[model samples]
Target: MLIDRTHRPWLIFSGAGLAVAAIGYVMYSAMVVGGPRGGSAVGLTYGIIGYAFMLFAGLIGLRKKYPIVRVGRATTWMRGHLWLGLLSFPLILFHAAFSLGAGSLTRALMVLFIVVIISGIFGAVLQHFLPRLLTERVQLETVYEQIDSVRGQLLEEAEKLVADLRSALEGDLSFAEEKQRAMAASAGTVGGLTFASGLGASEFTSQIVADFFDQQLRPFLLHSGGHHCALADKGQASGMFSQLRVQLPRNFWPKLADLESLCDEKRGLDRQRRMHHVLHGWLFVHIPISYALLLLAAVHAVFALRY
Candidate 1:
């Protein structure tokens, strides 16, 4: 998937095989009476070999589907799928004598093959680079399916932090101490700020913090919240939090910093979701079309043999 050094052997083998096939096709074309026709023995051999490569490539899906059944190493199958799949295209062209088929079924198969190859290449490129990009961008990445659940947890955590801060600001030392202890036990430290003994601030500042969280941060954390929320943008969120910090007492800054960290984590999750979609989205187009191509190719092969 990463297209690293492990791919080297497959790449070398594929390149060598392609070169040999190209050479054979060239010699066969030159020696043929008119041109290398698909019905010719050499051309038929080319088609068979190309189709075999395609079948092997398509079986990678089956390999994935039944991963528990160890036919071979998955990495081997994947490498074969990527390299042999690519090799099939040029071999298929050689089989067709570099012409789009004159018949409707063959033409359709050719078109479908083209689509599959292009989509496969696109997917390969994405797999090669998007993983590294995802790693660099999403530090708090979680399981893709668990993103919603994690977001819910983050919301709860933010709410608890806000309540603790509010209690501290309102001079409820006992409640704030209990909450801070709970926070320390659960989260330890947030954004490098340790949970300390509650520092008292004005009830007015607590109300403003509560109002800001409800109006801006809470909506941004909600499941149905759209990207139109101001906190969705990093610079805008930073500026808003900066302004909120100016209004609040210095003691409340740690809780606010924790809130900002939570928001940043949420943003990272959102980014991971989008990138995950992009990473696999090509399969929606590639897979179904590939199956169709394989089916039509079978039909074409049968028709060629019979008629």
Candidate 2:
């Protein structure tokens, strides 16, 4: 929340320029007079106002992100951002003035405005609601990664499977007898292991039938009760994302995919990175299309000039 009050001069100056633009737009009706066939004076006014709001929001973001170079405090910048987001839509729509069909440039700008507005709203949702959810999910993700890593360690330990099988075979262990022993020796331990310590019980033994080999004939292993049996139960209980948890949901988590690198370096990160990405990315949509609209506008303008 640092602002150099000393830079008040610049802030006042820029703000004064904004005031001038706003006042001029509001008072200057004749400037908006256009061709009889296309566009509306009132709609253009609304569009300009909305554009002003959008521009201010962009400025606020830029100032906050680069506070050292900013002339406003974080709180003030945030206030500006919030107010602009709330008010700008109506301002720009005034520019549109409900006229969509009469001009190519108007239609193009309308599409751009709609896209920008929707993307901005999504950004707001990310800023407000998404951070808390992401925090809980991050903790949950930590747990899942830890589980996977612990499962890996258990696999390392389970490497003793073949050697243990050989020794048991030498004792002439029958498949039924081995099942009895493995079950009795470890009734609740799944795969003769546990999920605790990332290695307490494994889910591997219960999923399929065990094979009995000859020569070094050993008794087949039996299923031990495991927590993974409740995976479906756990997901259903969460109520967060039943649809996404399918076939390794924890590993291929969705939120992380949107803003992974940013989340690592910052807290309360949420989908800001994703929002910024889309905002800037959508510029390609806006800029090039604006050109087409301008081209058409120019065609209309030239046709009018000759007549």
| Number of the top-ranking candidate, with lDDT as the measure | 1
Give lDDT tens digits, candidate 1, residues 184-225: 544343333333433334677778878988998998898533
- Candidate 1 ranges beyond 4 A from true positions: 171-175, 179-204, 224-226
TM-score of each: 0.89, 0.38
Backbone N/Cα/C clashes per model = 0, 16
C-alpha lDDT (0 to 100) for residue 207 of candidate 1? 87
Q: How many backbone clashes does candidate 1 have?
A: 0
The weakest ten consecutive residues by lDDT in model 2 span: 214-223
